[model samples]
Target: MAEREYTAVVYSTTSGRVIYDLDLADDPEWSARINDVGGGRITVPLQGGAGTTRVREWCVPLRYSLGVLLGDHVCQAGPIVPYAPATDKRLLTVGFKGFWELLNRRVLHNKAWNPASAKITDPSADIAITDSLPNIARAIVDHGTTWQNRPGSFLPLDLPAVLPGTGTNVRNYPGYETASVGQRLQEITQVDSGPDVLFQPYLTTSGGFRYIRHRMLIGNPLLVQLGGALKFDYRSSLVALSIAGDGSNQANTAFVKGSGNEAGTLFGYATDTTLIDAGWPALDMVDASHTSASVQSTLDGWARADVALYGTQPEQWQAVVRADAAPPVGSYSPGHYADYSVKNHHWLPNGLYNYRILGVSRSSGTPRGCVDHQLQAVRTG
Candidate 1:
């Protein structure tokens, strides 16, 4: 097989303009996550020629972004950040975090301006939004991107389109809260009746380089079966497998405390009686924060979701597969379903198990040419 070459380019964050092209990146590796910010790394020699110096100068942390490409397709992209130089004093490495970091940097409320004082200040009341889960998420992002003293080139991102009519989720951000946009999104989407939030990147057909699209998807985005031709079969594509089971942090009961003081405080509990009836002691967990939860059902929603996730012995499966294997890299992303099977075990029998893909990681220039897939069992009990 021929050597794989990866190229990179830097773009201005505020104006989305091309800043520089990184033609000499070494050891480029990237990772993507479903629920959190993903990142990548590229290395350059410190003593290289004029171009190397240019890469160092143009890579302004937080102001610029790096987009890695395989031919014309962008494999990974993110805002550039500083990293400690490589130990040998020969190479310099810079890190780039995913576009999701933009959400992390902003808050729930748009900046407010006072006419008489001629100044901008935080809103007087908390941001309260009640809508379908997807719509509510989009609202948070829309207002979160707006600020009072933005640069001239700072353009507010357009609200993303979301699937219609999926029940409702209530979120409240008190005036004092200033909660992170990313954290707020995660909190709303990870609960019962919530959809999965995905920040996907795409290249523009015209002149726009790489752009990110915020999406809310319900359930698994793609489903793979045990006998499907495109799968991570243990007999073929699976290079190595590591299975881990842990119940140390497991809980069968959850007491969710909502906003209020003293006797007026809202409290809700959800318990998985099946676990207790099966001889496992009733382990309890308390989540004391929904400061904006006005109704008891809001706290109950969180309680049920928490109990479902933490109520069982969670198992994590990490599998490494050849990059060119069926359902290759880029073909499958986080939130897809994978049907895995292991043949003949002494204690664990030969059977098929379903898991939801949580993350994907790959490193170019490695001898293995492998993609690491992280998965967790889809709890449906």
Candidate 2:
């Protein structure tokens, strides 16, 4: 069976309590509706740390957890808007980001006196493992009790050995951009940690925070054969395909230049390539606020990864497929959804099809709740 009802649960993240629960309605096109859902991405918005908006004449503050419920599962979207008023003339255009989106809104952990560390030291020498993304990710996420679901790292960071007590004082600021925690984390996984550690921050269907490291964009595939896939009477289906290439997913030559506060050589370069291309070149510079030799090595590793992704040959891509199915309305199912534990229809790498509900939105219309939410997936292999 499919679900036809929805409830937007509002609760204080500050206090962690249910304040109100608003259900899906088909009254008019001016209230609320849910649609455009993805596995880890959705569109739901809030404001300030607190405030109020008019819902059916009643004022609802912009604080607390704004969770969406459909069928049998509930997922936390984010905090409510803090300061929007009920009488604002313009339509309050608020599109909250997935948990990962919100998480990526802050800078990574780095300070003037001390920056995040990517250096590898003997297990006995350095206990903090400071700059490690896995280590840093935990510290960054373990802050609030409001929406911090499960905090852990799944990165198989089988980092190789490094000399102990080499640059005991050398450090990297990793730069500070009022950017997102996700963005800051990007700086490391893409440039600092190099190929040794690459990760993608994601939110589980259960609302837990996790890092998809080794999987890259390729998770276990989902089979959609006649009797192999979950049974769903889908109403509509869409498959979008595209291909691209840098003509260089792999290179025999790679280089990285860096900059920072420490005073060393004015010019330096790093190469981790082993191929004999006569001169297959892949180059990049890192202003990620690094100047140490360790940083140079890290940058070199990044160059190698880039070559791997854009050097060797044309990158073969896949198409994205989306569907819409809801709880059985009678004899037809419009979309398909299930628990994270079950084989839900969400996105996957290598064509494992599944779906996750990001959140929903509300808009004014002839019938307030008349929006079609779609379930999107990738073309299964």
Candidate 3:
């Protein structure tokens, strides 16, 4: 049997926080070398090793003004910008212009040497944009066909307005609240002029508001498929209740958890029940007398309805149940069920909050059932 030669490549991120490792098989045609390999470390030549490969190299020049800080002994470190070799299969994080430059240089310029490849199952862009109601309708008509044909794919859209009185409004249409704007734009743009457009809203939820945004991705279940619940006592603001309903309180002063970007806060846990017996807090931060079962049921119902109408399966959706003794407003913070205006403040003062649901066919990848866009007129405080 021919000996199989392998090379390990380990490189750290620019921030020095993440380290990536790659194992490559030696191919004589590539003429690569594994200079050293031991103790979980390997080094390879800049060229030659494995099969034919594409590599991106970057270099940064550094400058410095002499400075030192110390009381007993002085030590110095220079400012250095690091470089890491880019892998072929991984997505490259770069600026828009940089991406365009790379695409033009590697893909477009070297078409003869490297054939421009396309995705076999090219999912539509995660989000879409549009401006007019008729255009949104037309987008639904068109993209809807494609989405229905592909079950796992998603399409979203952004538009200036979809309110009831908007010139190109489609809120009156049923199921519009659930249909994504991308489908709407694809349906309407082909037929008429629409307004300015952008990407669709990606939805996420957490405790407290019952709809706090998280870093998780929406539309695709693979991103955040894990389901669990957690509980915390705002009164102490110190300890975390474990998923096993065990009180594993940490002495760390910074311990708050949820979906938002706040630091030292933990959010959802892995268990369906919490160790703390307190009731779920109200939206206004006032203590609610509701039973945990009741609150859990309400949240479960919302998730179930969402899945029944939009999700492909019940397991694809998950929710976090929080028990707070105080209402959000009572805590002088944003309240749950606050009007859409307080929720999506990025839009103009009068912009409405719209809801849409959509279903795409698993076989043909075309869109099937589409809820017309629902526009809740933006409320002025």
lDDT of 2 at 55: 39
Ranking by lDDT: 1, 2, 3
lDDT of 3 at 152: 21
Compute each candidate's TM-score over C-alphas. 0.82, 0.42, 0.17
Query: What is candidate 2's lDDT per residue for 106-126, written digit by digit as tens?
Result: 343332112222322212212
Regions of model 3 farther than 4 Å from truth: 1-149, 155-193, 200-204, 207-381
Cα lDDT listed for each candidate: 0.66, 0.32, 0.21
Best by TM-score: 1
Least accurate stretch of 10 residues (summed lDDT) in model 2?
Answer: 212-221
Which lDDT value does model 2 have at 337? Answer: 39
Tell me the lDDT of candidate 2: 0.32
lDDT of model 3 at position 102: 12
State which candidate has the highest lDDT: 1
lDDT of 1: 0.66
Alpha carbon RMSD to native, model 2: 12.4
